[model samples]
Target: MSGTSPSVAAGAGQLPGTGRTAVVTGASSGIGAATARRLAAEGFDVVVGARRLNRLEALAASIGGRALPLDVTEPASVAAFTAALDRVDVLVNNAGGAFDAAPVAEADLDSWARTYEVNVLGTVRLTKALLPKLRASGAGDVLFVGSTAGLVSYEGGASYTAAKHGVHTLAETLRLELCGEPVRVIETAPGMVRTEEFSLNRTGSQERADAVYRGVREPLVAEDVADCIAWALTRPHHVNVDLLVVRPRAQAAQHKVHRDPPDRTAAR
Candidate 1:
């Protein structure tokens, strides 16, 4: 909002600031990890947040950044995280998950609630907690890693989709509300990103996880979305991408994929 900002294609990177500080939630892995690295390489002080202490710490150590324990679902955790941080230039809320295989009729409310808790409330909790620091930093930027599910609903993603929709709405509202101020709110919706733990974590089973992406060609990699994020966050002061949708070339929309034909002779 105030101090520094990026390039025409963001290939050149963001503005130079020795004190460029950023707080990235869900920074333990995937897009978060990639972004943290990108920012660190750019000379910014980075703070990585996540529930997995070992992973978070390792990531933080690897990037030479600070690590903070944060669970978006927990207020105390979020509060502690933000309270300790100062001079926040960028906020990357990349903490959301999708449950892969539960049918709507057999949906478990408990799991569904957990999904909402971490996906929607988690982002809200962390964002609100850090607003003061973000605002004070002058160049306050809040970026949410929403999903294409928010834009398009699909099978077996009831709760996840709902939470993402909430994220979309939140980003929109915050953009309008914070427009008068220095703060900038933006959201990126990724289609199907093949991250390390996404499938296993989402399905709650390793075997089932493998089946989710069975035979889908060239799924979107975490770096793909991470690169988009790096590019998006580095935009100039007056230029806000606002909303970006990124997905695999093979996938046109949520729940739709271009699969290869079966090997009839080799298969059972």
Candidate 2:
């Protein structure tokens, strides 16, 4: 029944995120790493976590934050990661990836299971483990790095789409369940993001991954998504950004993409 104080409100001399701790999962590279860096610049004490301790440590050092090893798909890893944190004001659930792009008829059950385990189950595991800390922070944020695949179905994308759909619904359900709580549940669904390993990991080949974004102009990069995440998290505690959908200018929809002619592009 209370609201944010003027000193902590937007336009205050001190940044809204100052003194708070933000935890970003899958932060070794790509969006997670970008979000962690952006949040640190926004004045939050950042903690970067991922299975890659080397990368995480390097990133954490560059940003003047801390790094810890975390594999959300493993329960023991999740437990250890959660136990290591003393306080968490923000949780960015970005430790997810698509394994394959096969069609539903030719679905790889192993791929489907892996997709679900990382994107859906892993997110849930970390979120559930950190809810208490989030609630305790008084003004907490839980942001999910979702994909446009969650909003619609696409050919050869059922496995990833299904898992992202689960993530979308999970955010919705948590928001409803935490109606009166101080914690905010937010989801940022990005379309056609050109990250380093996302498509490469999904398609299993550099050529196939390159083909996924061969045309048009600039696609959304990890920094673009990270900007959205930081903006949403920095708003006044009472203002909850429920969902944000971002896409490249060349992308009109899941099925509608504007690609320039190859010859014209080459000429330019």
Candidate 3:
């Protein structure tokens, strides 16, 4: 469907996102934070939520958005966050991470639990809580910041992969359930994104995290994924971008990634 109708074109402001309200979770950093900034620039009333209130407040102040403390894992936090908002035209579910990369044989149960708790259960909790508001908006969007791990599997990433897979299915199921409704379920699966804390938190050390991208010439950054998200959200309400998989030029697939030779001189 075309986004440029005469009525939309004749609207007051230059931005298509004018008069929309967007709520982005996990907005303390990475893609979530970048999306908050981009949506604000797009003229949407942005509200950022995260466990880190200080950073959220700073981001809110910078972008003229609101900040609310949210821990998706906690029912109370999700309720409070939901209650604090009067309108929500878009919900960006981005609060998730890979905690460990242990193989199945050597899997740490605790790590597995945490992975599922944050990436799957927590996401569901928040989504269910805010779905009523999203439905009330009449033209709402639920966008999940999924990962390539959800699509394909590799060695030593079972915990993360499984959780992401859950996220992928969650988006799909929601789309089916919301058929004929105005809300759109979109999933942006990014591959090899090098965020400040993603690798560090996954590997548990700077050295190991550095090794994860040792020879990669260019890895996707948070902003790249954020751009995809904004583009999808700003599309015509009738257009539903079911799934968008984004990766850097260096990454062809989950198993295949092009990398340059290690820079020995830089290491020295």
How would you order the candidates by lDDT, starting with the best? 2, 3, 1
Residue range with the least summed lDDT across 10 consecutive positions in model 3: 1-10
Where is model 2 poorest over a 10-residue stretch in terms of lDDT?
1-10
Off by over 4 Å in 3: 1-12, 264-268
In candidate 3, position 171 carries an lDDT of: 100
Better of 1 and 2 by lDDT: 2
Clash numbers, per candidate: 2, 0, 0
| Over 4 Å off, model 2 | 1-11
Between prediction 1 and prediction 3, the one with superior lDDT is 3
Runs in model 1 lying further than 4 Å from the true structure? 1-18, 262-268
Per-residue lDDT tens digits for candidate 2, residues 1-268, read 0122322433557665788999999999999999999888888899999999999999999999999999999999999999999999999999999999888889999999999999999999999999999999888889999989999998999999999999999999999999999899999999999999999999899999988888768888999999888888887787888999999999999999998888876776
lDDT of each: 0.80, 0.90, 0.90
Residue-by-residue lDDT tens digits, candidate 1, 1-268: 2223543323344444346688888888888888888778666688999989899888888989999898889888887887788678889999888764577898888888888888888888888888988888777789999989888887778888888899999999999988778777879898877878888888888788777676777788877777777767667656788999988888987756887656732253
lDDT of 3 by residue, 1-268 (tens): 1132211211565676788899999999999999999888777899999999999999999999999999999999999999999999999999999999888999999999999999999999999998999999888899999999999999999999999999999999999999999899999999999989999999999999989888887798888888888888888788888999999998999989887766752564
Distance (Å) between predicted and true CA of 78, model 2? 0.8
Instruction: Report the backbone clash tally of model 3.
Output: 0
Error at 205, model 3, angstroms? 0.1
